[model samples]
Target: MARRALLTDRERELIEGGGDTDDELRYQAVSRVRRKIQEELTEDIDILRENHPDLYAELREVVCESN
Candidate 1:
């Protein structure tokens, strides 16, 4: 099977385990989701990332985290 591009549980755990502040953790999570969304959802992530923060976040949370 093709490796799923969506963030995996292990990836999330490792990222969470890292000694980072809340802001840093949130950044990492969003960044990871954005990258995965770009891979599977759209190439023009800049548009969404810049113009639609709420949509961008929802997509990342609903789609990227539920693999």
Candidate 2:
């Protein structure tokens, strides 16, 4: 799998371990990791939109239709 960018130490540890502890803390950590990933993906898509308008428009249409 491709390695993701900008992961914090806590995120790395959480992803690697299966140890069960506080359920609330685990949920929060998972939410934070998901948010970080979404932000990174949004940035990448913005770059693509700027660089390739036609492709971006096509992708936008497909995404919108799915939603």
Candidate 3:
């Protein structure tokens, strides 16, 4: 079993709230939120690889990483 990344309504609120103030603060907050989302996406990919090895291999061959 793998750890799941679950984003709740409260978590969404917190992420959104981080952008309410000054531009610098909002930029930092948005960056943090983006990092968190990327982490979660990676975790999800890991779990898929573990549970569906063949599919994962196929996906890896077909998908390209973005900048």
For each of the candidates, the C-alpha root-mean-square deviation to the true structure, in angstroms, is 9.3, 5.7, 7.2
Instruction: Indicate whether candidate 1 or candidate 2 has the larger TM-score.
Output: 2
If scored against the real structure, what TM-score would every candidate get?
0.33, 0.45, 0.37
Candidate 2 wrong stretches, greater than 4 Å: 1-6, 52-67
Model 3, residue 52: distance off in Å is 9.1
- Whole-model lDDT per candidate: 0.68, 0.74, 0.65
Return the clash pairs for model 2, or none: none
Let me know the TM-score candidate 1 reaches against the reference structure: 0.33
Residues 1-67 of candidate 3 have per-residue lDDT tens digits of 6443344454445556654546665566667668776887678679889999887877677666533
Ranking of models by TM-score: 2, 3, 1
| lDDT per residue as tens, model 2, 1-67 | 5675556666767766667646666677788878865887688779879999887887678878885
TM-score of 3: 0.37
- Model 1: which residue pairs collide? none
Cα-based lDDT at residue 49, candidate 3: 95
Ranked by lDDT from best down, the candidates are: 2, 1, 3
TM-score-superior candidate, 1 or 3: 3
